[model samples]
Target: MKLIIGLGNPGKNYDRTRHNIGFMCIDALAEKWNVTLSESKFKGMYTVVHRPEGKVMLLKPLTYMNLSGECVRPIMDYFDIDVEDIIVIYDDLDLETGKLRLRQKGSAGGHNGIKSLIQHIGTQEFKRIRVGISRPPAGMKVPDYVLSKFSKEEEPVIEQAIEKVVQACEASLSKKFIDVMNEFN
Candidate 1:
């Protein structure tokens, strides 16, 4: 089974925040596949879907962003999933808003969520989809900025990016991840 994890803090208050783009993408995929993340365990909310290729698990870590790895590692151990068989989706402040970047391996680049993941998983080698939220404005704290909601002007763009992420993820289920990256990135 392949594991797709979207990083985010769980709660209604966090819904639609810039940092929750990962969750948004997972949600989009769930809707597309007509599945529900109705199961909860291992510090996450998830659902397993059977596709022609195999079983795919969509996960949203409920440990919030900083402790995401705590949630991920257990699920991976329980499922006997390899690091390569997992894909992590999260917000990126380095890229422009609504842009998407895919990498097979890389450092955390100061992202606490990724940092925690690397600490727990013991490797920087893993597939990742970075959905750009853009850097915070001058004088705006990073924490505050990440938790803020997108403006009406940004909503459509982010929605498009989320749709693109969903498509890329779906493609990865059948095609090699590299192929999906080539097509979508």
Candidate 2:
């Protein structure tokens, strides 16, 4: 089974914010697969879907951004999922808005959520899909920028990126992570 985790803060207040792009992508996937993330467990919301390749568990952590590993580690342990079978989707400030990057393993690059995951998972050897949110403007705080919603001009771009994220998740089930990265990154 594959564990696909999208990192973001929980609740309506964080909806559509730049920091919540991960959640948005998971929502998009749920809609695409006709599955509902109605079950709450492991400090997160998740649902399992049986695909041709195998079973896939979609998870959206509810432990907020900084402490996301708290939710991921337990769920992974409970499910007996290997670290390599995990794929985390989250926002990145290094790439331009709407861009996506896939990495098999790396440092968090200052993302608190990824940092938490790396620490708890005790390794950085998992796959990751990074949806770009772009860097904050001059004089703007990183936290404030991430918590803010995208501008009107960037909405369509973000929507397209979310669709790509969904496609990447689907592809991961049948193909190697490197192949998926080559196709989408």
Model 2 gets an lDDT of: 0.94
- TM-score of each model, paired residue for residue: 0.98, 0.98
> For candidate 1, lDDT tens digit of each residue in 1-185?
99999998899999999999999999999999999999999899999999998999999999989999999999999999999999999999999999999989999999999999999999999999999999999999999999999999999999999999999898888988888889988
| Residue 26 lDDT (model 1) | 96
In model 1, the runs with Cα more than 4 Å from the true position are none
lDDT of 2 by residue, 94-114 (tens): 999999999999998999999
Q: What is the C-alpha lDDT of each candidate?
A: 0.95, 0.94
By summed lDDT, which 10 consecutive residues of candidate 1 come out lowest? 170-179
Which parts of model 2 are misplaced by more than 4 Å? none
